[model samples]
Target: MKLLPVFIFSFLLNALAVKGQGADTLKRPIAVQLNVGTQGIGAAVNYGVYEKLALRLGVNAIPIKANDVFKISGFNSTSHVSADFYNIHLLADYTPFKQQPWFRLVGGFAYFLKANGNVRIIPSDDYKYGDLTLTEDQIGYVDLNVDWKGLAPYLGLGFLKTFPKRKFNINLDLGTYYLNKPEADIIGTGILTGNSSQTEQFQSNIKNYRWLPILQLNFNYKF
Candidate 1:
């Protein structure tokens, strides 16, 4: 039994060596890539460490804003929605088959420098306080905020090649990141003060929201 285990391990090592030998070797040691997709626009630097392996260091960010997107029944409200996300990551790419150099497995970890989403709703016209109409300034606004600003682990697959066969090439990525537990809260002013009580429920609803999907395209240039 002991000898059988040793034989299996040796066979695996030999198989790995043979796979590496058959892979298309990277002619360039370093390359720069521009990434565009759901995570936003970013850039990465890749370093070929072995024939079938490479390391990537990258950064990405997205900032979004919208107006008049949220409202409640019987209320003339204007809402502003904003989201900002920033991340820095280090990833590894490995080509498992020499015959399929265009396919690769990717794994990485990212530290979110900033990840926050906010929605603020303000009365567009006037609010009736029982018998009187309250001004917009008096009614104020309600703000709902959620934050997921921490480390995340990523796993995905890459298509095409890591580096260009010529000088430039394009690749695609499909992946997802497992984010940390998110925190959520509500803050209100004036008549909206009562909405703050909903913070606990908001937090509960988003507690399990940990997956961040990614569909990206990368343009790479060899150096």
Candidate 2:
């Protein structure tokens, strides 16, 4: 993951050199972009290699956490939920119509450095056995974890041109990433130790949760 940016930068420099030697009429230019959306905030470098074709290399990260957002149907508990995702991607933008430069078909693949979700559930109220109240540690907690870390393919559409006519431009990307299958596990402590048996069922239920939707807005600056 640490070397990804170096590779992308090297590739961008090579593309620039090639563009510099091309014909003056060729619409090959380089741009830098910043974006934000469901995938989180990120930045990318855009290189126009042809009049209707461009390439982008970028990285994105989404880290979110919430408290008391989840609960068991018949249990009184407080849950902490968190999701963290980090990826590096390379994308191609192709304009199918010369007259419609503002519309583009986007295809890409991302390598996720980290993709994980966690839920920790703790009993909110004290439990009593006969006349004795059980301590929190005696009642214990349950932790559910899921990881989707691998290559994901992206397919989307872009609105607005890949490059600015002058210095800056704004665009939108509407897409979805099909993530790899996830690995899930359940851990329990103290009285909840038996919850670990549900790991298999949890994995089965989340097998199909691979689609990650993206609605991103990009701000571009031509160089």
Candidate 3:
């Protein structure tokens, strides 16, 4: 009767208070971010899940190459090196200190779509085989390729707020990723055929190359 209406009114007031409290705890519900770092240029979307927790989905890529950078003793050659790294990741950001929301703990996983490094060395000097000079095609190149394309775990710290009180903010992330075991191969043409035999040794030497360090800057826009 009359009591029921009063009870409903009270419940509605309580619900409104709870909703207001939640809205105060979080500044923004969604954000878009741009990243630049050792991992390269990337973009991410962030969603606020709680007062001090957020989740982000991001993608990044880096492609680099250099020419004539390596030299073998007693050999005249031109060398080229190149690397392509790309990944898609999901990360959780937790801010422990309510007073210092700028500092956060980050944990996540990334799947490397492409992670490869390669080096190629080609002989530029003419080779004399006995009394005859070999053509450029006769003295080909040696190529070394390494790949670590798989799932990797990431642990890091984030500086600055996950989302700004205003519309835009900047943050820094420092962390490292533990990469999976790698597979390597060596390819050679012409007189470099014997280089393939060194694959096993190279793999052993690089077996411990499983750390990917990250120092990134993120520019965020809250929506």
- Please report the candidate that would top TM-score against the real structure: 2
Query: After superposition, which runs of candidate 2 have C-alpha atoms over 4 Å from their true positions?
Result: 1-24
TM-score of 2: 0.87
In order, what lDDT does every prediction score? 0.84, 0.88, 0.85
Model 2 residue pairs with clashes: none
Summarize candidate 1's per-residue lDDT along 125-145 as a digit string, tens digits: 767789999977679799999
lDDT of 3 by residue, 132-207 (tens): 9987767778998899999887778999999978899999999987787889989898888889999998899887
| Alpha-carbon RMSD of each model | 6.1, 5.8, 11.3
**Which residue pairs show backbone clashes in model 1?**
none
> Which ten-residue region of model 3 has the weakest summed lDDT?
1-10
Q: Show where candidate 1 strays beyond 4 Å.
A: 1-28, 71-76
TM-score of 3: 0.84
What TM-score do all the candidates reach, one by one? 0.85, 0.87, 0.84
List clash counts for every candidate, in order. 0, 0, 0
Q: What is the lDDT of residue 107 in candidate 3?
A: 75
What tens digits encode model 2's per-residue C-alpha lDDT throughout 54-103? 99999999999999888799999999999999999998777767899899
